[model samples]
Target: MKMVKLICVLATLLLPHLAQANPIRIKDLVEFDGVRSNDLVGYGLVVGLNGTGDGLRNSPFTEDILGNILERLGVNVTGEQFRPNNVAAVLVTGALPPFARTGSSLDVTVSAIGDASSLLGGTLIMTPLKAADGDIYAVAQGTIIAGGASAAGDGAAVIQGVPTAGVIPSGATIEREVAFDFSGLSTVRLALRTPDFTTAERIERAINAAFSRHVAVMLDAGTVELDIHATQMRSPAHALGRVENIMVEPERRARVVVDQRSGTIVMGEDVRISRVAVSQGNLTLRIQEAPLVSQPNPFAEGETVVVPRTDVDIIEEPGIGLAEVNGGTSLSEVVAGLNALGVAPRDMIDILKSIKASGALHAEFIVR
Candidate 1:
């Protein structure tokens, strides 16, 4: 009984501290300055489609590329006027990851650029992907596994997902490596995904404490420079590997985000609200038209007359009386106070907006 009582007492004391601070790995919070991905794109051809390819007449570029491919294959048909229904023109795209070496494979996406109905079960021809510098970095070729399927009859058609785009896993081979001298660098920068002065200061302190020296300096709210020579590590790479795993508690601003389209409300732990009163009701107006025709004495008279009539009604739903929401010092209290009105999500969104307008909500309100 004593051991159980001690365990409960410890849990009660530790729960509040655990809830107040959440330490996340620095790697997940910051992006290494030179560690990034590059985008590569290329124009290619997809063939063997099931009659759902581009129409040569509508998309003449498809025919031009096809002729070029055939000419390169020693096919001598200079004046041939042939149109095939099993070919498509596509744009291939992929991202070259950081530290990628030669002969590394990358996943590529094939998207139909012409009027192709679908790329399902299509084979992409060998295409060289180029970077922004107009240098060929990789070559991509593989069978496309389209995300969608399509079917049609004479009058109607049905397509699920996107049939014009597909992905090929590990479809491209890297031919060249990006030139970067990581081991020669003297200092490296850590770029925060979200800039905050307090978070930056905390990160600086955490790194310095870990190394037992001032190795990191906060340049600004978004950047922190690390002195690699001070760490006495083998290289900048080694220094970064050690710093990336260090846990640091980050600070976030109080915010309440609401999506009007889906009626979603998301409040941060720091969100607070002052005491306020709210009332909500709905108003509905309905108009109905009724037309009447009158015949004169069973066709005794030659003319008939028509009359139009309309009925309009206005309805106002019973509204909840003005309810008081007490000021909240914590997230749970704020949620509980607002929920006391027993309103629907859509109505609650309006109430939050009103509270913000009245300067009672002590947080940034974002409506999307």
Candidate 2:
């Protein structure tokens, strides 16, 4: 009884700490296995391109494919010839989720892989899309709604959001089904995208604590196994239905990410810095050029000439004061240390990098 009393007292004492960031539910942190989509792709022809289709002479394969299709459809060209300026070769791709069935429509993406100028106002014909196993799984046909427009004049051409590629939502009808049995498993694993030992352990504890039993167990940094007993429903669908809805507070590392191209910096709330000094300076380069004419000396038959003059200078910008950044004991201290440098947010990228290189930044640095 005394030990239980001591435990209760300790729990009460830690309430303040838990109050700041309490444990959330467990469903938001992991993804269940065997619940993913499969990729399907096929090469097909889009017709009705306004004279922008691939040149038959350049793409002999296109001509051969068209000839084969026409022959298969009972149109023969033995000694005759045929050519059209309407058909463009395109690639059709889509995702075939597990348990995909016939008659179900899936969104398909059509892209022109040939030298077709534009796929705008084109109609995709009946194209059989196959899976990785070379088995036909779907047939797609639709009028492509391109995202942008393209036009050309004598010397210049204007293009926007790739009119060659477009998406047709719920356009491809499934012709074959993939095999999957969800109810044949005794256990299911949940995997975290970013694996941290502490986060994995917390997820395990939260799962077990929520169900009030040891149903979930931490297997490794990346996986957590759950025993499907009283904790999980008998039906796999019911079990997963319950699993995805439970919200779990995700864990993230103390990181500062910088995008060099866009000049954007993102810092986590827990990012810190040790006691260190930072200084920053900028260098500017300037150049000037002028031309002067030296006339013939008062018609004395001296040849006219020109003199070129130029000036170049370099200026070293003043340095930021030696500001000390202490360990981010609090949010305000971190903000204050960052603001004290008085540099533009864009310029702050360099300053922060210098600080990190000097062993003062207490968080991981990521640059893109």
Candidate 3:
């Protein structure tokens, strides 16, 4: 009887902490089905480079664009052979955000598509941005803010950032809108970023509970259907505004993510480990080649001879004995056990992989 009471008390104490660990807003975990961004792309010309533009001989496209621009502006250059070094051909791209109105401006990205040396201090000429359906959506024209720069002197050069790409704030004016009527929709779908059966059920329950009714239904592990008509709300937007703030405890799978290039290791809070013994050792091999030149002694007739010597050595660092890592019941204990190994992040990654292979790490191992 006493032990049962003690266990109950412990459970009561841990419940709040566990609940606080996973509280997340619905907005962070899911996206509305119809609320999205549209891609806009355009081909344009960037001028005003300081002799860092495309070479006229190599990149004829730059010259062609310049000629066309001049002709469009009432200047005839049909047979001109002048070589200009202050212009470059570029591609402008941007996203037309959801519900963007006509005449609204958007930030656009400009990138040099030719052999231009740099896009620094360049201005994007007026260009028509088109969507995938071949309809003009926006007109982009502004001064480029290149994120990088480059400099060269004689035989040496120092460059920082990317001078061949840039961004212009509010550079594109929206000329058209996507054919989506948000007000006519009676139902909205929520798409989970990371789908799980438990998470879907939780979201459904939380949304329904907030309204004291069953307006939300879990269609699948990745989707939840919300009935806008049944809510009797002013609009779908009103319902979403109220529903997105309702916090729910999200469920996540136990996993360990490792990035080899960056030497980064990330383990989920739900990760677990069984009782395991680990040992680590490093072996290194070294090879040295030295050639000796021997001269004929005191003007002897024999030509100088060369002798080659090679040295090889193998060294192994002393490894720790098989240290037992206790099975952990919580994330903190698991982290503490791994920290006790006193290994580098990369070494820890290898050890985790070995543990996973041995079936002692109770989580999925993802290598990136």
Error of 1 at 230 (Å): 0.8
Q: In model 2, which regions exceed 4 Å deviation?
A: 1-27, 230-232, 293-306
- TM value for model 2: 0.87
Candidate numbers, best lDDT first, in rank order: 1, 3, 2
> Whose lDDT is higher: candidate 1's or candidate 3's?
1
Candidate 1 per-residue C-alpha lDDT over 163-278 given as tens digits, one digit per residue, 9 for 90 to 100: 99999999999999999998999999999999999989999999999999999999999999999999999999899999999999998889989898977787777788998888
Number of the top-ranking candidate, with TM-score as the measure: 1
Q: Poorest 10 consecutive residues of model 2 by lDDT? A: 1-10
Task: State model 1's lDDT.
Answer: 0.90
TM-score, model 3 to reference: 0.92
Give model 1's TM-score versus the native structure.
0.93
- Candidate 3 per-residue lDDT over residues 262-362, each given as its tens digit: 66776666788999999998899999999899888896788888999999999998866688899987766677777777776777778989999999999
The true-versus-predicted C-alpha distance at residue 111 of model 1, in Å, is: 0.9
Q: Best candidate, lDDT-wise?
A: 1
Clashes of each: 0, 0, 2
Candidate 1 ranges beyond 4 A from true positions: 1-18
RMSD of each: 5.9, 8.7, 6.2
